[model samples]
Target: MKSKWPEKLRKGLHAPADALGNLFVESFHYLALFGIGAITAYAAVATFIEMLEKGGISVDDILLLFIYLELGAMVGIYFKTNHMPIRFLLYVAITALTRLLIGDVSHHKAPDVGLLYVCGGILLLAFAILVVRFASYRYPSTRVIDANGKDMDDGKV
Candidate 1:
């Protein structure tokens, strides 16, 4: 019979390296997320201050604030659940495009095909968000667990 000791010995030696590597990488990753969240919050505050100075807020300003909110929420969710919901990203992109379209079209009275293109892009992004949600519902991640650390097999959340 083949000796099982060698395999056990190898695994024991490799475990520390795997664990340390994960710790190193995740530490920096979370640090980066914190930095991004901080910068986003700062920028959002600056934008709000600018709007206050002007004594009025435009639709574009509101949309810009919405973008910042989504970004901040994305970072917060990551810290809370260790998972980033991609729908937040799609929503940000769609909001950005809408802001761009509104700003561009409102400034000039002339009609252009660019409006159509931007609208199409927004529609495509909406469709992508639906697809992501559908896939998440259909084939969910297996990391769902209950209070006792056992996998919950009831249904997708």
Candidate 2:
């Protein structure tokens, strides 16, 4: 019969190795998120400086800034809750599309086509947001906030 000692020794070593792998993966995840948040913050500041150099800010510039704000807020929410909310993404898309429509309206060869396409996209996004809101309200998640405002699935509020 083959010796069982080697097999038992290998099994004993597996647990710590698996744990270390998990720790590395978790650490990398957080590091990537931090990098994304930092890049977004830097972009916002750079945009602000460019806007100031252009003499003054306009509505399109403000909307662009709002998109950047939404991006930062999305990253913050994900870090805080580990759950990304879809509404923030929708808000970002809507703001960006609006900014594009506003800034490029004068440049389009046929304004009607560009306006119709952008307006259609915005309408679709707004409809999707409404549907998501309705579903969330109708079929609420079991997760609830604790006193510290953290989500918990343990049926405690």
TM-score of 1: 0.80
Candidate 1 collision pairs: none
TM-score per candidate, in order?
0.80, 0.81
Q: What is candidate 1's lDDT per residue for 126-146, written digit by digit as tens?
A: 999999999999998876788
lDDT to native, each model: 0.94, 0.90
Give the clash count for each candidate: 0, 0
Write down the lDDT that model 1 would get: 0.94
lDDT of 2 by residue, 52-86 (tens): 99999888989988988999999999999988899
Candidate 1's displacement at residue 34, Å, is 0.7
